[model samples]
Target chain A: MIARTCILFILPLLLAGNANAHHSYAAEFDRDAPMTIEGVVTEVWFKSPHVRYYLTVTDEDGNKVTWDTRGLTPVKLVRQGWMKDTIKVGDRIKIFGHVGRTNKTIMSILDVTLADGSVLTSRSVAYDIKN
Target chain B: MRLILVALLTFSFGVHAHADESEFSGMWMLDVKIPAEPLAGLLEIEMTDDGWIAWVEGGPAPVTIEGNHIEILVDARDRQGFLFQRKLVGILENGRIDGTLTSIDVVESAAEFGEDGSSWSAEAFVKEPPSQPVQDISELSGTWVPLRGVDFRKWTMALTPAAKEWHAGYDARMDEPQKRCISPGLYSAVTWSFPFEIVAANGKVVMLYEAFNLSRRVFTDGRDDPDFFPNSSMGYSTGQLINGEFVIETTLVTQTVRDFNGEPISENASMTERYRLSDDGQRLSVVLTLDDPDNYERAPIRRRVWTRQDDAVIYPFECDPDSFFRQLFNEGRMQEYIDRTPIRP
Candidate 1:
């Protein structure tokens, strides 16, 4: 059981190390600043180069704001057991990601918690999230 | 009994000569070793009444067969979309062909480097391997995946005064062509964690990269450089096998930065690369020397390695630039990025 647990932990690191991501993450997102949002999915663009999710979140003032979050490619997500219908519209989800350097509403997705309580990691394999 | 023995001897000698001549007539899979990367491709050789003709990945080229020596010239494109020519010379022995791969960018040779090209040693096989444990460390062939742990950007250069000034003001977010879905050229392309297939046929070695679906053709045939040509990202390359190392020289490259750190490579920049495979044929090591007097005080050397993965597949990299910007615009971030970007007059 310990060997299996070690394999599970090491496998993600190995797989994440090879994440091409295509563009430089540091160029677009700020690594120092991390954010989490619980919102309802408005749209999902599952395509090549990258996959984007549009979510509607309420700010501290109770004002609703649309956030654009990016993740890995479709092929990569599919390999990770993510399907087009995995996160449907109106599904309330929680997202953990890094905020964009220029855009506050834009973020690079790191992990997601679906309405069903299942957790799915976005393609920031090289990124270490510190609690 | 003496007459029968003499007749048998004559028949045996005739069969041996025939086997030597026909050995090269078939389909061959090639694993070509480039600096830090291994390219896999296929070669098909055929004989006709006119002469010998070879097709490398369905592209036909005329060939000449002289006893154990084979020669051919093939025309193909580099990763940067430049036209280049490859001249290949091979020697058939024991059901295998081993020879040189030379290249000259038809356009760049004429416009820049007078006439001389480059060459490298390449080998061909009837069957792709891991079947037999490789004994020669110099023979590099097969699919090799990038080792992610090795950061190639750690190699630094002593920049020229002008280059240093340029680097100081560079913005990676705005200046990076790769972010715009443009080909990052040869130097940066080699550093990418993408898979590439290398094919050595008749007189040329071809590399098909999964990144942006780019391909580069290195010529091994004995041909003079052209008189004029245009500059491109990958540039024109010539390769030769020297003392068991595949040596390649590239020139007339397009002006571009070497990496995300804003390291620059001028059009006058040239590169020399040496590739060596491990004795097990599982790892390929490359030494790259960058010479750009306009950008660096002296040539900088970079080393990289790739591990052979027979099951690795090269996939299509279809990039959507519009979608990239759409997210930024939709999030109202485009204006902020533009406002913060430094403008150079």
Candidate 2:
């Protein structure tokens, strides 16, 4: 029973190793620094290589800051039933992602919660397996 | 009674041989399993006045059929614009052809057909009763997503000494073009984590990639590469069907790294790509062979498999490198990137 369980766990890791993001997520995003930003969607570019969502959030200083966050490719999002119109302009949503190592307002999105209380994961194969 | 039975057996063998020869003409779906992965392609065989003419994709080659045994030689170009040869030898039985497929890398071998090559067992299937309807050859037109269960970046490459030195000093933060929203070029573009749509029409094929919104135009109208065309990331491409596969040759690409790891491709480097759809049309496979004498000891072959996803939409990839760098500045890591980045003299 122990051997069978080990095989089940190890097999997926082996398979998921190469099935990750096209580019190196670790190089761009800081895995050590995770952040959550709740803001209104300013724009959405639901395109390939990655999907970008711009959000305007009010900071502690009462200044509106726009954060540039991106998620996995549209292909992965489509598999999860997310469409081009999933997030529209002015939609209030919460984003959880890894901040860029050099850029604070740029993030690699991991999960998103819509205003309607729907949570969607934007994790790629590599990021999903690691985190 | 024994002599009469022997005569009947001989007569039945003759009839069966004649039936198998007639059945060899038709469209066949070929499934070949290489050591790394399985490949699918379409083969069409028709009887002509000279002999059996087989159109593998759109490249036409003469096929030799003797009894139940068949032999065909296909002069195919890889993604690098190098001509390679695939020799298929199959035996027909029960409406199925089982054979050996051998690929010889001519550029590496310096011979028309390489002396030592890779061979795999291949099976060709005909549409039997109760089988799904065969997909039209033109159904290769549509959006395709990279079938990502397996990692293609792990393939070993034979880098030259100079290439090895260049790769050793690579820093992903600054050197990786994709990070700066630059086009990853053809080799990386095909296998990137995105959807690429193929539009085929009127002697032209256009591939729209979601990565950087890169688009490649392949002329099938039988025109040679222009003499004075400027080099670009995507390069010049011409395509034709050869041996049941859509073969595209790209040349005059700008000198760029083939992948994120900084494997180099010279401006003179060329790529030959073969795109084939499975019989059921559910899967599309591409075999890309790169020929760059300046960067590698041998031409490397990269195979990519994509599943048909009708609902998958290609989105515009407008990259903002300024925003990316701004984020780094916000995180206080912009200085770190500058420190690690090697300044080219």
Worst 10 residues of 1 chain A by lDDT: A1-10
Worst 10 residues of 1 chain B by lDDT: B109-118
Task: Report iRMS values in order.
Answer: 22.3, 19.3
**Quality of model 1 by C-alpha lDDT:** 0.62
- Per-residue CA lDDT of candidate 1, range B1-345, in tens? 999999898788667666676776777765444333233444566665544556553334446666677765554432211234556677788767777666544433112122133333334534323333434322454666665322213212456779867766666555566655677788876766565667776676777876666777677674677687577888888887766667778888887786544568888999887776667667776667778899886565555667777566666677767766776577566886577455310
- Candidate 2 - chain A - TM: 0.75
Instruction: Encode model 1's per-residue lDDT on A5-26: one tens digit a residue.
Output: 1122223224322221212555
Predicted complex 2: DockQ: 0.05
Best by TM-score: 1
For the second chain of model 2, what is the TM-score against the true structure's chain B? Answer: 0.58
